[model samples]
Target chain A: MTAWITYVVTAAGLTLVALIRPFLGRQNELFGVVFGTRNIRQDQVGRSLKQQYLIETLSLAVLVWGGLALMAWWHQQPPYLALGMIAFLLAALAATANAHRLSSQYHQQLAVPEAMRVSVDLTQLANEQTLSPVWGMVLLPLVGVGFALPWSAVAWANLTVGLVVGGTFLLTRHLAANVHGLAAAPGAAQARNILLSFLLAVAVVAQGFGLACAWQPAQAGLFSLVFGLLTLLGLLLLLITWLQVTRRQAPAGAVRTDNARWYWGVFYYAPNDSSLFVTKRIGVGLTLNYAHPASWFLLLGVVAVVATIAVLSN
Target chain B: MELTVDFASTVPIYTQIRNAVIQAIADGRLKSSEVLPSVRALGSALGVNYHTVNKAYTQLADEGFITMRRGLGAMVAEQLPAVDPHFEAEVVPQMKALFTEAKVRTVDRQTLVALIDQVYDEGWHH
Candidate 1:
């Protein structure tokens, strides 16, 4: 009877998540640039992998737990439950992979503001349109640090690097905040924010990895406690800084701007993950709808590390 | 000073802010030279748009509610200008309705309280 109840509860939870996924999916709507000949928004390009299988995320979670419960009940081998979990996950991931890159590209093209256009051809991809090779060249190192820093120490170096790099990127962003620049020259800001987000993600992931490693085997319990508190502090600082920079942009986009100041009010990017993908962009306008998902994974990583340590210590 | 903003409302946010500041002036809640909240400070408070508030201050300068020059932000009007005493009486109730509306769709008090608690514990505001 208890097993039946648990199964029912899991099914119910999955149903709720499936039903609610549409709304959560819309949160990313604010991202993506719009440069395609046919304008596209982040939300219009079909649902994200998570949204498409809203039920999948929930159902799989339930299945992992419920299958274990049923295995215990029926005296079945639990390893098969694990195998089933892996199978469902791999299939879901494979289905969603490489599905919407085209749509995001189109959105990025349209996102370019009208005044900032260096090139008139809306149909061109970023590479085809002549961009300042110097900008791309400069962005290479930033992107390199972002993608290559697998180890925590290399990530740590990004703190000072972030200040210098983010400051430079932010200066450009502030200057480019107007509709003229956003519409006329979309990729410059896109290029910079993408680089900044990537670099920050590298640093944050490094920080999370470091914290996880800090509490490893037989470290005094006090060490874990101190490290946990410190991790929490670092997370707070990152959040505050993120808010400050984004808030600087929010009011300009507020609908009530005096029409005279509309020139100054033309920024389109959303903070963090809502940036538009670059495929569809014309050249200008900021895209804030689709940020790399690495940050969420990093946060989850921290939680997973702490949870694992708790379970292991037990 | 408590500040608030509603993005969805039909009224412009700067106008809403101007009303808040003007109401404070009329109510004796704001004494002369009592230093109105800075644009960034109040923007965070109202959660409305900051540019709207800055615009309001600029308009108030045009209307003589306060004196402002570049780099020197608006301060309360000196020597309290002659104004209708009943002006505030007409404004307060409407302002209350606006506040209620702002609060209406916002995350409820308990949720905001929880967020505040989390901010305190996690130091997210810092």
Candidate 2:
């Protein structure tokens, strides 16, 4: 029963996030494509695309949930549960990709000759936007000590997962600090505050869960339930913040319609852009600038870390 | 001080940075001895090559607008540099070109003098 409840919570939370992801960006964006100051909701083409996106996403969600229900009845097992979760993720990605492709058809072209352009707020240089570097530096050692105090195979696995989350938290801070025009974007500060706070909460929860599982694996189900509830709360906060951000008008000269630099209305590629991370055209956070040489290194580092963790866990 | 560089501008990025800093200093937007962001940070924030910002800083230093100390980063000079003969010599041709353009455009002497006066007074008041 506990397992069933956990699966349901996880599925519901993921579905909510997927449903809201399409509308969680600047007002000028439509499915990750920039359309300048044009009102996407009022534009005929944009309205049609949005309706299509909703219909597709809802249909996929229904199919995935129906499959999960069948899997639950036929075989109430962990492997089947994992398979169902994987199917849902794949479906969500497919729906989003289709929407993105459809929206790319209307991407506006600007007269600017550059493939990508960056704007910086000179006055905001002194302001500290991300969490302090000291926290990121200290997190790993503290978590390591916690893992060592009660050593077990479960502890080792928990340690691996904790390290991954901790590394992501640190990387997020780095990207947040490097984002161009983060300080100048309207409603960006509020959105960033919400995101950073949620990440900090998740990091803390991860550490606590790791230690809890190490000490008492029997209560893992209870901890999973608590984690799911917190996740749901976080996603709700994110959705509310997204709505507020998407409602605010983009300031004059703020919207860069550099659709040429973005392939498939998602991946950013501009060789002349020296930034490793730029503010996302489609989402609230930063996206990788694939043209930067260092981005490849960063990607490799993440892959290496995940691979190491996988090998260690086994 | 808000510095903006347009990619479409005919002026090079480094020159734009140099001009913006000079203008900010003239208008008192950049106070004396104020520290500036490191070249790498500015370059990253602007999504430009670090060397571009380094060149701007080097020119600013050469022009006596800012001081750069190794490892300490750039700082606005404690005292604004006086206009040297070399600087005046460089400005002469530019001014002459503008004056000739104004003449060709049929701008009257009084209007031209008033425009110059307005521009000169605008910087000091800041």
Candidate 3:
């Protein structure tokens, strides 16, 4: 099979999974990282389960189709692989944005009763998980070895990307250490830190493979095998974590406001709320409070950056 | 320590935060010299602006209920400040107004005393 066929298959499979996710489990239990809402009360959200499913399915279908079309058009030209990648990336982003918009609409329609609204304790929310700086120091030698090996432009570019991505994970660890209240929820904090470390390790190893590929292009088959295996393993790890999070019960006294004041049960917008980001009442992630002006600026900034990256990468 | 703010309440968000910390301290959930969450972290967790948390922390610091260090964040004060000499003067009028309203509502002196005793027993500060 051509490389483009593999990309098309993967994209289609993932979209199909997303479309069928709601039916596979309890409504509240199905947490979509990018496209799904948290445990919003169905009655209050004003959207039937079928409606949400339809919305996600249609958006994802469009995404997959767009990606497939791009792959098909660029398939004959190996030099256009970068353009294909950019097209797929943009399609994915659009799908996510569409999902967010639909989710926000549902949230805006919610009618939360006063009694169910609860407040979060800042102290308890403080994150205390930390990773030692020594871990980064230990990886410096691998980076040195990678640099010492002979390199090509593409190999150097891949290595640079890997290092940058790996460095982000390390930076996240450092930032997480300073965040208060993370320690209060040690399980989540520790899991997040471990995931970051795992990603960092994977990036470093991937850099080594880039070096190998640069040195001996004939061994590309072996590298692809290893890459495929790693991808599968990463997906497995993600699935395990997602299950653990969704299965875990909400803590006692968690605010279960049925209100759609949170745009789409994801982007929160309570004018009185002074926080820029709040822990999700129904899910494992943090949501930006749209009521805060800075939240909009931040969201816009993120979109701009991603759009720029997609363009430049193409 | 548990903290909550009612967005619909007339109470200011900063005051709610400040009062919650004070209540935690009184309930012994937050101990003397215990480090409190950083303003930014708490703000992010609660979905409030960091400045709102900073305001609460600053107010607590001003009241000598907590101390703020540059890198260490805020910590509960080892010794809470003594009540101001004018505290009684400031409180008595409010207390009298409350009692007058209770009396007008036909609440007996005994019931008022009982309520006060219960709240006092619950402990705001040691």
Give, for candidate 3 chain A, the lowest lDDT window spanning 10 residues: A177-186
Of the two candidates 1 and 2, the one with more favorable lDDT, higher being better, is: 2
Q: In model 2 chain A, where is the ten-residue run with the lowest total lDDT?
A: A108-117
Candidate 1 lDDT, tens digit per residue, B51-87? 6657888876666677765665557787665656555
Show where candidate 2 strays beyond 4 Å.
A1-11, A42-44, A63-91, A107-121, A128-130, A137-141, A147-184, A238-254, A304-314, B35-45, B49-51, B68-74, B82-126
RMSD of 2: 5.3
- The candidate maximizing TM-score is 2
- Span of 10 residues, lowest total lDDT, candidate 2 chain B: B38-47
lDDT for position A224 in model 2:
73
TM-score of 1: 0.29
Judging by DockQ against the true structure, name the best candidate. 3
Ranking by TM-score: 2, 3, 1
List-wise, what DockQ does each model earn?
Answer: 0.01, 0.33, 0.37
In model 2, which residue pairs have backbone atoms overlapping below 3 Å?
none
User: Which candidate leads in lDDT?
Assistant: 2
Distance from true location, Cα of A76 in model 3, Å: 8.3
Measured on C-alpha atoms, candidate 1 has an lDDT of: 0.42
TM-scores across all candidates?
0.29, 0.74, 0.64
How does candidate 2 score on lDDT?
Answer: 0.68
What tens digits encode model 2's per-residue C-alpha lDDT throughout A1-314? 75676677767777877776666666556776666555575777777887887788778877887677776677755425566678988887787678777787566333222223455655565353646645554446546667578556545655655565555555455243222343334655456556666666666676667677667789988987788678768867876775586456554554445566776556789786655666566555557889877788878877887688678768
Model 2 CA lDDT for position B7? 73
Docking class of 2: acceptable
> Candidate 1, which CAPRI tier?
incorrect
